[model samples]
Target: MQQLRTPHVVVVMGVAGTGKTTIGPLLAARLGVPYAEGDDFHPQANIDKMSAGVPLDDADRWPWLDAIGAWAHGRAGLGGVVSSSALKRSYRDRLRAAAPGVVFVHLTGDRALIEDRMSHRQGHFMPTALLDSQFATLQPLQPDEAGVAVDVTGSPEEITARAVQALDALSRPAK
Candidate 1:
């Protein structure tokens, strides 16, 4: 097993519909850490693009990722929870650059389930039409990354439990 880092900034990451928003605060509350919403970090321009059903390109995402990263950096050592799609390695790397010893909780599920959830969600800027683009852009957590991948097949509470369990395991001192 990898030697995990101490006190974490946990990022509940996945494509838009994987329940980052739903699970982030719950997980934070469970962990007793402060919660930060990734979507709130987006500037109006990015929100407008996604709201219009246009998939964001790399150039469009860097600043937004950097903003999220800034928040993560600020929470380093302090520990907290924040949610981001973090759909690519490059984006995750940008986050890592700003925040040392950051860990991620990647929520994953199949297409049908994700689309169903996305379709029913209300008042979100991201349109269902752009989910395909999000999956296309997704890069799951790699072996070297400090994180765990939890499937989204269960209820949000169950998923949050899984995340908390996994994070607890990672934080335990080696025997």
Candidate 2:
């Protein structure tokens, strides 16, 4: 594993069913950091809305983003991994506001593959029906964003490895 010059709070971001939950813990373990579940930060109302196939508006997500941001801020120099949908650029900006050094690992994959994974998964509150809205809301990490976009076409381990490699590259200083 590549050593980070300065520990950073990593946010694993993607649409629902992109394996953020699975990858977040593995990435944290690899980096010797704590992990936080983004879903755990959601208010019950938000959960209920998603569970019922209702897409969340920005108003419904502000508190949730703030909660995740607070967790990231607390972990600042200590380094940690957390999962969040963070589908919109504005949402990501909010997170960055709270944790200036936070880096994101955005998972990208084919829509059909994601839907298949969502269908097979059990007990997740986010219904497959919300996926379209998720894609609609997603603003992928732009060139100026401090993040990496890892393709999700492989196994969990493979994807996590890609993320770690990309993050390592990001942490390296220019030669």
What tens-digit string does per-residue lDDT give for candidate 1 at 1-175? 3445766798889998999999999999998889999999888998999999898899988988898889988888888999999989888889989896788899999999999999999999999899888888999989888889999998989999998888888778779
Best by lDDT: 2
Taking all chains together, each candidate's TM-score versus the true structure is 0.95, 0.96
Q: What residue pairs clash in candidate 2, if any at all?
A: none
The C-alpha RMSD of each candidate to the native structure, in angstroms, is 1.3, 2.5
lDDT of 1 at 100: 68
Relative to the unseen true structure, what is the Cα RMSD of model 2?
2.5
Off by over 4 Å in 1: 173-175
User: Candidate 2: lDDT over CA atoms?
Assistant: 0.93
**Consecutive 10-residue window with the lowest summed lDDT within model 2:** 1-10
